[model samples]
Target: MAFSADELRVLRRALAVALHPAPLHDEDVQDALLLAASVDEAVREAGRLRAFLLADLARYREALPGSLSGYLELLRDALAAGYDPQADDLAALRALRRNPAASELLARCRILAERSVRARLARVSQATATSAPTGPRARLFALPGGRAADDEPKPNPPAPAERPVPKPSEVFPPRRRPVPPPPPEERAAG
Candidate 1:
């Protein structure tokens, strides 16, 4: 999807601020917020490009003889078809516009589709690399990589400990007893 000049300028500014070492600085905070906003814009652009591509491809399919086989060939050589969008995907878009061998609108549409796919891929990759993991461990504890305040130690109150109680068994002593047996009964029986 094409970025408006203003949006591109904003992206550039945000990127610069985010990459700066002093994130705690006021400018850095503003930069971070701008970057977050840009993310939503990027998503919207991607959606727009996806719709445009699909519509173009449908048009191409209806117009050409052996168009299905031609698309299959394009798929097989898709990587060679091009993925880079140097200085924006202008060159690739131009190439699409020039293809008289195929339906002009359909070819352009496919180009738009490829460009959208590539743009989204790049954005997702960038986001994944920068964003913290949303796993259980990340949720339970703050890591060093988090914001500056996350590194600060929290204050905790000291606990009061009580003395342990002594057991009754420890203070008591054993009593001695005299034993009497069955000697008298045995003598009587005998």
Candidate 2:
């Protein structure tokens, strides 16, 4: 298998956490480990089939020694399983002495497989790079302009207000204060 024991263990742990999530789990968590093991076993078996078929196609070369279509089918399977038929894989294919038709088919398969691997890897790498965070500290810097750190929003400032001037009547209306007349005895003396 291409994966080491530790890799499979990590894969299992990840699967288990995804299946039955818990907060306080360590590297050797139980349920996740079991699920990971099961997944690893399945993947290993599938890989074996893919590798065997790819190897056979690379070793055989005949116009119809074993059906050009059949060889192409094997290559498709390998590609689907994430195999990259690059220089090494092509070298293996070149070693085969199949007929012209089979050779052509194998060549096409190799090209397609290589393309698929490259495209998928590119997508995966792009996703990883985009999601990778630089650091928490970088978020503290001030943005663009030299505005104050806590400046209030200025998108829409208060509109110019129009104060109504008071009319003379409104400013000084007649008062109803009581007026005191001269004393009654003074009036009688007069």
Candidate 3:
């Protein structure tokens, strides 16, 4: 899975072709397909490696409140493999806070955890903000006359007086139909 620089270059080129479709020569197409297969294999290998690292991390974690050095090393390896540190990791680090060997690593882990949290929050907030309604709008499909994209003429919302409130019964009427009994012969068979 570990590609040499030459392989990396080839992989990148193949990826470029895949991402940006253009008429490729037969040889180029074949090369890209081969590279794609290699990439898939590499991905599988990375996943296996990650799983092994996570297992190692768990072993170290369970041996914790001791073996700070090994735990920290495994923790770093897990992090490198895209493992998110959990509450248990934080708790363990906190317990090891007094260990001089653990102080720097503890601080580093705390920072990494915080940074990850902030990043996740920011991503969520960005998504929410983007999706949230920004006032009533019948956004123009085609450009409006003499209006820039920013000056989009939005449709006005219905006034409170204009908005009709439905009665509960009207909104959700009770079901009228009852379940019919099974045929006599069918019921007898059952």
Candidate 4:
């Protein structure tokens, strides 16, 4: 989308006018309009190109092993054009992983697929986090007794039972008494 020198000049003038609040001349206005139209056309052309590439990629994928080389080439081009690899594309690449090119493409496609999954999950999580109720929700109907759910007294969880403390003797057995002087007598005799 390289702009012509004349279009660049017009763009710069338009920016200046936007910043400075000056009235655009008839020629400047016409140039700006023309540049805008050119940009729109370029965007449309890019979309069409993307659509064509995707269609070509699908055809190549359908052809399978017979079109391995062409499929790989088309897949590369599609990836370069920011195509999000679909499950079918990943499965096809996986099937052709015997090919070095297919293996490389499968790795790249896996990364793209993971990123897409993560992005979708992030969006869903973000939406749920934002839209989910944060406070106590109001009950639509009363309980069996016509009492609001919130108005009922909440039951408290049971307290844990206390265990009896073990005596010191139970925790640690008493040490045996030392041998009497008989040991010393025996040593002296020896």
In terms of TM-score, which candidate is strongest? 4
TM per candidate: 0.27, 0.33, 0.61, 0.68
Backbone clash pairs for candidate 1 read: none
> For residues 1-190, could you state the per-residue lDDT of candidate 4 as single tens digits?
7988988999999999998998778999999999999999999999999889999999999999999999999999888878899999999998999999999999999999999999999999999999999999988964465546567887676667656789999999999998676677788998
Whose lDDT is greatest here? Answer: 4
Q: How many steric overlaps does candidate 1 have?
A: 0
Error of 2 at 111 (Å): 5.3
Runs of candidate 4 with Cα error greater than 4 angstroms are: 132-190
The lDDT per prediction is 0.56, 0.66, 0.81, 0.91
Query: Which pairs in model 3 have colliding backbones?
Result: none
Candidate 4 backbone collisions, by pair: none
Model 2: worst 10 consecutive residues (lDDT sum)? 59-68
Q: Which candidate do you rate higher for TM-score, 1 or 3?
A: 3
Task: Give the per-residue lDDT digits (tens) of candidate 1, residues 1-190.
Answer: 4666765766676677669744465765675577667777888987776566545544544444446455434423332444232222233334444455334534554676678778899999999988966666633675565787666786565555544576776667566576766698797998
List model 2 lDDT by residue over 28-104, tens digit each.
56645665677789889888887787667575424334454675566666666666666654654565536565477
**Cα TM-score of candidate 1:** 0.27
